[model samples]
Target: MRLKIKRSNEQRLITLPDGATVSDLLNEIGSASINIKVGFPPQTIDISDTSKLLTDSGIKNGEMIIVTDTIETEVPVNKNEVAIATVSNQNDAPYVQIDDIFLVLRKIPDDNSCFFNSVGYCIFGPDSIKYPDSQQELRQAVANVIRENNQGIYNSAILGGKSITEYSQWIQSSNSWGGAIEAQILAEYLDISIWTVDIESLQVYKFNDEMASRFCVIMYSGIHYDAMALKLDTSLDEEDSQICVFDKFSELGTLIEDNVLKLTNHLKNQGYYTNTSTFILQCQICLATLQGEKEANSHAKKTGHTNFGEVN
Candidate 1:
């Protein structure tokens, strides 16, 4: 029997035995380098029920099966904020401040891979042993996602001058940078929503909002990005390993008020957010001066220097 498997912007026909189980079909496709071909991790076949055989699942010869990477998990929702909460009382402005809400920002290295590193940190936390090569893994994963979806979403027009192949190669390059585009792809690939809060503008950029099962909020200064996790309750002992996870922005707004308010304020107090146009940045390592954040970032990338201070 021939089965049509549709996945990641491409569809293929596969031959299988008449009595084969869904598991058997998946196993057959799994070994055929499907993951590599599709540029995603190994996916579990969803025939509504996994235990049923292909024939039992209503799969017939020459029938089509749509493959999807997202598997809905039973995440508990905070009932208090099921409806979208207004961010502000002033005619729905973007930024809002919540009382008693705090976040712990996990700083990633100032390397070009901060976006990837922050994503890794959000997914696996700060344990090096558990996620030793997460940054590299994610970088390659992003490239694969782009490569697999090339003809459609990641085509040349969207990528500017570079072709799909060039963009894919660049995504895996360490020196090549990752930004909002990469973040959106990562969110889709991971089946999560990423809320990127811009410190200076106090603007929130959401990626994969439509199909997100979980939320990973990260702080984005104009020049860099860092992971932000809810600070555990002070009443809880430090030894307690439990952490708070927000499954949706509405839940966060309902629970924490304006989560970005505290984050933006913290960034302001730490001198992370500044008016980059007029800010003077001086390299502490080499004593070289740059006009603004963009120039400083370019200098740092060119010189392999991470130490820099704003010279007011």
Candidate 2:
């Protein structure tokens, strides 16, 4: 069917051939090239300007189509911390001090140094857990977990110098509140420096203006969002929305590994041959055959301390 077209932006008039789809006309138009004349500037028209006409006046066949261009003042998104800013000041543009930032970033294991070390020794109980004593050996332990399990945690999962991608994965999928809660649990168990606090508890007065703005977005998202969204809509377009924040902040689950044995193998390869602490701790909780009183007495006798009183 013959179709009359109207656009909202550029002024132009165009006619479509019979049995044509909107897709077909778009492909034919190519780029913004003047194709046909429909009317004068007083009533210019273009297919791109169809939105206004479509909203105001419905399209009709064999009718003279009218288009109007409305110039919209673009909103400035640069002011939003969650938004990307253009290079206006070449000399004084602030750089993101990402070196020490840990809290709000997602893909935890990727950006932080500890996560990298953890990933290297995935085979052991605490896959690549960072000990003050040995770093490289811990990294090997992490790698071993990955090799044995053939998978790795998407989020940070360091337990005393061993990485546990499986635990991280479990925290992500099964939890209702998201993986942040589980990540917090793991961080707590390992005594790692992954400090996470709710936005509601944050003191606004402590942060400066720019920091306040970024913090506002992070808080609103419940620290669940990897990259914070700016309050202003225009801020949405400044940076690539997908990669707004390169650091890992979201509670991503284990991207690698499935079984505990494979994870142990990974640890052994990294020179982390045992999880005796984990085993002993578990044994103390379960195994009815074990004597807690005797163990506590032995500890008290060996150290000459009264700390074993709780064990009785």
Candidate 3:
């Protein structure tokens, strides 16, 4: 059986006879100290457990095994760790509640539309027909709103020095990121408030001051956006079951606020946030280490390399 071994973003194919063990693979790879993980959500293999066979260890052929010098473990949803109460909403959708409001941070795909994607997910829960099938649609909607809905307000003076036409054009561009203006426009467009939890400062910025029937929460981690939803399952094997939209009742709002504070505290405890102003970043394309968001943006514009990751 051949296994694809990945280390440091590079992969190699190795063929071993049937019944090869971790010890055998280590001997073949000539690495004495390494951590090995394989499979979806990845299962850790104890390097010291030499007697275990690859076939028995769930590392199948044609599968990929990641080898890292440092040991790594998946961050659990910790759903059970949070106090849970299960109950059905009027729509009969499943939800876990903490003070009648449950929200878990969901990692959004980092295609550079994370803000729109997070908002889209919250505006219409994943299964709803009203959900935009693509973030492109949301981006277009934002552009249109700027162009037609509130032209005088979203004009040059307020839109980060860009003219309204230019801002609209930029919003339609796939590489553009969303911020407070987009959030406000989108919240008003949806007629629901948006509470963006800034993980760095533990600040919750509210959008849309008008009375609304419901509200949604999104988490901001430095340069990226992720949704805060009601997680139904904690197990990592299955994809998360979540509900983002919630009714705007007074008690529920307070509960959401209190629970959100708890959630942000939990995230801080887990080191799940990035300090935009100080966190070091690495440009994935050229492996250039940058100082912070400012440098990262400069690098992206200069090199047209949009992919970046926080460097610890």
Candidate 4:
């Protein structure tokens, strides 16, 4: 049997034995685990049981199968099960139904302050006016939160080797990117919970979940970040993807969390994933293929081959 390997930019083919199980394929690909999708439009086939045969697993000949060394489980997904991996997000519709409510993204501009803009959109409603300056206020707010902290949590180790003062200045610059640490600070500063979901991995990181009953959702892709909103109307007539913070144990909160999880997992299965570990980068200068971002950066530093693109 032959399988297709899909990465960020390139795809490769590998031949497997008739009895090659999921484990055998993983061993062949040099990955500990993998996410399998086969057939046209691609369906997510459970690769949890490594001993299951490919044919029995519903993989067919010459079919397009996306390969990855990762599996994300939000709910307890059973083994050897199959699920439709199609994306329902359309330009006209642009939202999905989660019970009675609708889920949609309030897109944030990618000016390197996407994180700030996204958080701003979450804090203020979807139609907020804080996006113009890329929300420099949030950056300064994050800087102040870190600067004023007496505890050593925002120390150099967490600052990625920069001193607290230096980090504050750097983050205050218009071009800096805000991430987990800043997220935590803002969660504390605003006294609200924040949940950021990675579409690729479908992992949700919750900040200040305990302190506040209010939380906003944000979606992150390889390129940039966006805010998640929930609204009542099915159509995009209403621009508010209403802020979804609620009592964690309450019925509404549970329902919203479940639906958000459902949406993320569906998107992940639909091949909306970015495998940062195995990004296929090619140097435009020497035509050298690099494995990942680390290798690409090192390649640029060593050979001065900075201009690069996807392998395509």
Candidate 5:
């Protein structure tokens, strides 16, 4: 039997035996797709239940299945804008919570440089305006850090089968993807602990777990990464400050330890977690929407409109 798996703007056809289960089809899709991340699982809703066997789910041959590789939500986050969520108060500090606890986060552009931009935003805040170029530099920095320690902690296992030079070149590429590996390298480079939260699994992946006054926490919904910040309540203060600084790790740590799991469960219950990926690529010169990557690349090559952003 054949089924059509629709992912983003692309669709793929997969063949399966007549009695294949949903898990079996998922395995096949995992093997055949390159866009899906390794650790993050793929899901489907063809027959209303994700775990039901295809044969038992009333799925017909050549049925079109909407395959979502990442968590889906209609989260309206723009580049340079912050994401704030209201939660129960868990702390008594001045910036902690006066009324409702808010989880503040910054949205990075949905490009290959998201990890770098996210790290940069956490580090320098609005001062980090370098964007794609800064991301390129940070990639080189990560590669350099690995190359300097190639014979020691950084090895082929860490690089995922690439040599030091090969990995260095790969990271420097504009289209190369970044994730926990890059986050770890950036953490060591900046000497700060980086915490990555997976929205689907509700697991916090920490890098450079040592104590630090200032650190970073990013939200990972499988494919893209976004920076997480704390929205402080400044009603008592005479002046309003948009950005809040953490004096101790315990402040944010306590909140995450106490409320992150509950918040995740709440988000799931509210159906805030979704699996939809749609990026609008506009020409920097004329602001026209390009058809796809090929057309965007062709436009850049012909008209030099290299400055493009993903409007989601």
Candidate 6:
């Protein structure tokens, strides 16, 4: 299998046999002996030291890879060790809590929406802040946390059915206005509640009044499709699951059966490529579902099993 590579801002290509793991492919390209960096925003795995990254991240053949040479510099200390050392050095300094709320807000409102595509965002004050590192594993962990905290903001018009671009804007938007508009938009659009957990003060705030004042909007609009889907599912299910549970595959079914003609017609008529394309694609998905259900029912009848309704 051929693998396209972008390393340290340079274009280089490499080839690997089919079914090769990242480690195996690196070996074939004489890069296994060197430190290899992978990931969109740049993350490194010391292939020369640890091959576990490949196995853990499920990196395998025929996939594009980005590898970078290791940068040598000052001696590094483990985070925990550094924290301990800092605490020891400063007698009166208070220790930082692991779950402390660390908010970094920007003040740029006209930021290009594309910036949010790079990360995941959420509404819960404590659950939203992701780690600083971009390591794939850590990023995934942060994504999971955001997913858990974010309940239903995705399906809302705040996202406008454009997940990638919408999120990019959220990430780039500054919190200079205390993120008031962004937070309010998310709350109104997603129709969910947000509460802040102050670890240091042990105070829980229902509204981020200070947050609003410091930034124009507290934006965590960026998110992956999976996270968005999860939020959408939770939101729809809350409104009488028996009638409105919206699964990805069953999206068209829910839309049509629930009589969402106005919304769907507006989307189709508006020529909003993002929503229109997704809706059209969902039609194909629903057709496949109908076919599958038909086959299942046929088999059930032949086997003398009870028939469950399609909705069930």
lDDT agreement with native, every candidate? 0.61, 0.27, 0.68, 0.65, 0.57, 0.30
TM-score of every model versus the real structure: 0.56, 0.19, 0.60, 0.59, 0.51, 0.26
Lowest summed-lDDT stretch of 10 residues in model 5? 34-43
Query: In model 6, how many backbone clashes occur?
Result: 26
lDDT of 5 at 100: 37
Off by over 4 Å in 4: 1-94, 244-250, 280-312
What is candidate 4's lDDT per residue for 164-222, written digit by digit as tens? 89889888876566789888888877777888899887789999998876677877775
Models sorted by lDDT, best on top: 3, 4, 1, 5, 6, 2
lDDT of 4 at 98: 50
Question: lDDT by residue for model 6 over 14-105, one digit each (tens)?
Answer: 76545455566566556543445444322445454344445455455444455433322222222232111112221121121111110112
lDDT of 1 by residue, 150-246 (tens): 5577777787456878788877766556788898988887777888888888788889978975677777877677776553333221212322236
TM-score, cand. 2 vs. native:
0.19
Score candidate 3 by lDDT.
0.68
Q: lDDT of candidate 4 vs native?
A: 0.65
Question: Candidate 4 or 6, higher lDDT?
Answer: 4
RMSD of each: 11.3, 23.0, 16.5, 23.0, 22.2, 22.7
Candidate 1 Cα misplacement greater than 4 A, ranges? 1-101, 128-132, 155-157, 235-244, 249-253, 274-312
Candidate 4 lands at a TM-score of 0.59
lDDT of 4 at 235: 55
| Most lDDT-accurate candidate | 3
TM-score of 6: 0.26
